[model samples]
Target: MARTKVALVGIGKIALDQHVPAIAASPDWELAATVSRKGTVAGVSAYTDFASFLAERPDVPVVSLCLPPVPRFDYAEAALKAGRHAMLEKPPGATLAEVHTLQALARDRGLTLYATWHSRMAHAVAPAKAWLADRAIRKVHITWREDVRKWHPGQDWVFEPGGMGVFDPGINALSILTEILPDPVHLTRARLEFPANRQTPIAAQLTFSGNVTADFDWRQEGPQTWDIDVDTDAGRLALRMGGNVLEIDGQPMAGENTIMGEYPALYARMAQLVRAGESEVDLSPMVHVADALTLGERVTTVAFDF
Candidate 1:
């Protein structure tokens, strides 16, 4: 069997640590090449610009973009037109409109365009969704607080205009919620905490239509917490470690309790989409972020220095 050639664009931290390794491990994918301005994976043929990458590896039929949201549009658009399927990282584009445009373009070109949401694909997430599918959800509380400095390190684009700061992490919770919940959720109110020296918020409190509220903070200390608690008619469900661990009514569920395996599942889903000759692009998470931004009131807080 010939593995599908996959070119990883923007070989940055995420690419090096997760995406590249996932592709290498998958039997269905072959790491063909890389496109990046300053980053590269070891032993992989690298090109600085897209023009050169396309010129050299025209046989590469799939491109996984691990780049930031701001410039994702141009690269994805170009890849689709060049007859390559694209698998995009979370928060697919800087704005919802651009992602929609890419979706339409990919569909028209008869290409597979996947907006990969890594969080929703976590081990315990699908089970949680199944557990809650028939139950009536009363409320959900998501506490997604983390130490950005430790996790993100020197990535400065996180504080820029399209960076979306705390919401960058917050969107993960939204993705999981949108997947598990039976009905759609809309943001009712939001209070964003912005550092005096930054353009985006470092912390946020958001309320959705169904009594679902999330607290997102990037300045957390000690152990990081990425948890979601769902109150439903069946029982109380809890997801810890960003949906890698699950608890039902305070009893931890057996099996499917693991981590570092989400990326492989994401790649598998992308491959399935390619083989099926279809595209799966969900805009719920991004739409929630955009709604929060539009209705959110910014509050300037203590300035943070990275």
Candidate 2:
């Protein structure tokens, strides 16, 4: 079978670590080209400028954007405008308004626009949702803590405006929460702790409708944590290791213990969407982050430096 050609934009850490491997292993996609200032995949065509890539690579019908949230809209806009199916990484865009604009443009142009949530594709996430769908959700508590230094290292863009700080990882938990719950939830109260030197918060505490709450922090020194525990009328459910591990009522269930499968699943879904001529833009998780930013109380924390 001939695979569809895809141009991977923003060949940074994530592109190298996840996207490239996923594309390499997939039967449906070929990494035809890449657009990045300083990164490239060996043996693949590379261009530093997006406009040149778009103009030269007319045969590539799909463009997957792994760029950071701030500059992502322009690339996605250009891709859709150039008659390419667009796929976005998590959070999709820095603002909800820009993503909505992209959606409209894609619809008008009859192109596929996928605002992907990789965490929702975690191996256990679907099973968790299935288990919860028939049960009654009493409460949900999400604790997403990680050492930014380990994950992001020297990436200062994470502390800049639109970087989303702790919410960057926190939104993953929200994505899974929004996916698994039987009913929708909205943020009610939030407390955000901002570093004295940063434009985004370093930690956040969020309370939502329907007894859902979250605590997100980026200052852990040792083993990182990404776990969500839910209390239901039937039993207790837990998803640890960023939704890769599942447990029910203190008994561990069967699932993958790593997040290695998420991007592959995402790419597969994107292929299906392209084939079906459909767009999947679920902004529920991003909406929760926006609400936390708007309604959250601000607190200044000690200055942090990498």
Candidate 3:
């Protein structure tokens, strides 16, 4: 099989830390070019604009869009129209309607489109899903807290309208929940706390049906935490370190590191889609975020600095 030539847009933190390394390690993909106004990866052709990158490398059949959700649809539409397969970073678009539009465009063009949920590829997630398949779930609790200053220092876009401050990380927890749960659950109640200076929330408390509840806070002073605990009739299940490790009844279970596993799995899935001439479009995760915004009650909190 010929290697798929790919270009990356929006050389942000995630693109540099995760995607770049993942692509370099994947045998099926070659990082052909990059588009970013501020940063450049070593040894890769870098362009200040997407137009120049596309113009110079028209033969690159795949484009991975790593930009924030606000301006995603336009670029995704252009990529599909140009007959290139597209890989969209999570929270696919700012609005659910735009995501639907992208899906339609991909189908019309017969191009492969991937809306990736990197968290769903977590190591312990699949095993937990399999273990709880036959048991009746009683309750679920999620706690995801991190220091914005430490993780996203100087990332101003997170507070902008359509930036999805806390939801940026909270969406990962939701994605994992949606994948692990056996039954469908919808948001019943939600309270969002936004820093007085920002358009998006800094903390969110959400309740879901099937007796499931989630608490997501993106502002922690020190020592980050990401954990999910579930109580079932059979036993107790707990996932720590963002689902990279699992514990059952206070005992550790073997697990894989999804940070290293996600991109390779993503490339494999993309290859399969391109080979079959199909597009994989699932917006349930993003739909929940939009629904939360439309239906959730907003509260003002202390203004955030940095």
Candidate with top TM-score is 2
Clashes per candidate (backbone, < 3 Å)? 0, 0, 0
TM-score of 2: 0.99
The true-versus-predicted C-alpha distance at residue 178 of model 2, in Å, is 0.4
Task: Residues 142-192, candidate 1: write the lDDT tens digits.
Answer: 999999898788888899999999999999989999998888889999999
lDDT of 2 at 5: 100
- Scored by CA lDDT, what does every candidate get? 0.91, 0.95, 0.86
Q: What is the lDDT of residue 220 in candidate 1?
A: 96
lDDT of 2 by residue, 63-131 (tens): 999999999999999999999999999989999999999999999999999999999999899889999
The whole-model C-alpha lDDT of candidate 1 against the native structure comes to 0.91
- Measured by lDDT, the strongest candidate is 2
How high is each candidate's TM-score? 0.98, 0.99, 0.96
lDDT of 3: 0.86
* Per-residue lDDT of model 3, residues 122-209, tens digit only: 7888898888888899999989888888878899898999899899999988888888888878988899999998999999998888
All candidates: CA RMSD (Å): 1.0, 0.7, 1.3
